[model samples]
Target: MGIPALSLSGLYSLKYGDCVRLPSGAEIGYEANVNFRNSYFIPDAVLRTVAGDIIAKEVFPIHLTEFAAFGWAWPEHGNDFMFIWTQETGVVKEVENPDLYNRLSQDLGETYFGASKDMNVNTLWIFNQLKEQGRFNSDHCNTKLLTW
Candidate 1:
């Protein structure tokens, strides 16, 4: 499954059992509740490249609300989030929590995924490809410049 493009229109916080109108005009509700896990937040750089639309500075709080409502887990590792970016659709794709994924997967009796060093390198490659596609802007990228 392809990750859905960030629908700026549907970007909003949701609460437990709250109804949401998706960009597709479908009304949906959280099957569960949402909560934010700061410990799992992927760094800004990773969010900007793979799932940029959802990570604006002001959106963190909303993101937290949505995370718990949807029972999502934030992936601590960069590569794991990118893999998520490659597999889901709509705002659901922006669900970058690996911890959440593992939990849900276990509940649903699905296999869990782990990262290898090679997978990490591949995620970097995908980030570069996104840059080429104009899905990323270097200016928005979080980077450090060192002067000697």
Candidate 2:
């Protein structure tokens, strides 16, 4: 039997076309550019099978510009990837407690699937590519510097 894998649906934007406050009380400015729109961030995620089987789970930080640039310049025929950016300085990392991480991941997954039942294959491909690029490697702290 083939194992069912969880897929990513649309990203849920926490903020849209405005300044975002970081955990450090600092703010990241959102300048209007060719690549500006509402943005989404998945602080963590968990995957499961339809049979109520837990497949895998993970926790990490991601800031994608594509979700914000959807209508502006995204989902091109062959170009469906976006750049990931992170705060370089003056940012405090919120220590994710295990319980909170699990809860958030589960909630995010449920919310995402509840809103949209279909997954964008192209976006998933790009996300996998980013993973291969070490952008999502939890072992590497420098990966936090990911940006477009």
Candidate 3:
């Protein structure tokens, strides 16, 4: 998210599906990039419906809705501030390749989330967004200098 606010913020490559277990046993998802449309992954939700958390609840109903809101599409690695707080406590343990959010969203039964399931759509979105600013090139497709 916010690079863990570490002295070596840009050192580690935090990939999607990369998880850090909190001392309380909760696992938080690390959004590696915006190449894939990611969501707040509930590890134990039925595929038929999702989006019940407060973060989504403020925009979406407690259950499924036709008008689901999307994030700004700013191409951010994305920060979960609550997760960052837990990491700050120094009890977070880095883990590799756990069940990730965007990967699970692909299996959602709702048609409203169809776009998020497609990885290429996000890839193109990032490319176009950067290209408009004259920052994109063939050599920098995977570059992490994505934000202002």
TM-score of every model versus the real structure = 0.23, 0.18, 0.17
By the TM-score metric, which is better: model 1 or model 2? Answer: 1
TM-score of 3: 0.17
Per-residue error for 56 in candidate 2, Å, reads 23
Ranking by TM-score: 1, 2, 3
Per model, state how many residue pairs clash: 10, 3, 0
RMSD value for candidate 3: 17.2
> Which candidate order results from sorting by lDDT in descending order?
1, 2, 3
Give the poorly placed runs of model 1, Cα more than 4 Å off: 1-101, 104-121
* Residue-by-residue lDDT tens digits, candidate 3, 51-78: 1111211111111112222221221244
Worst 10 residues of 2 by lDDT: 1-10
- lDDT (Cα, tens digit) per residue for candidate 2, span 1-148: 1121111111112221223222222222222111112243332122212222212222122223311111011322433222221222211112324453333323222222111324333333333444445422332111111112
Using lDDT as the yardstick, the better of models 1 and 2 is 1
* lDDT tens readout by residue for model 1, 29-147: 22212122322222222232222233211111121111121212245444222122121332332345656455543332222112221232222233333344442233322221110
User: What 10-residue stretch in candidate 3 is worst by lDDT?
Assistant: 44-53
lDDT of 1 at 123: 24
What RMSD does model 1 have? Answer: 17.0
Question: What's the distance in Å from true for residue 65, model 1?
Answer: 19
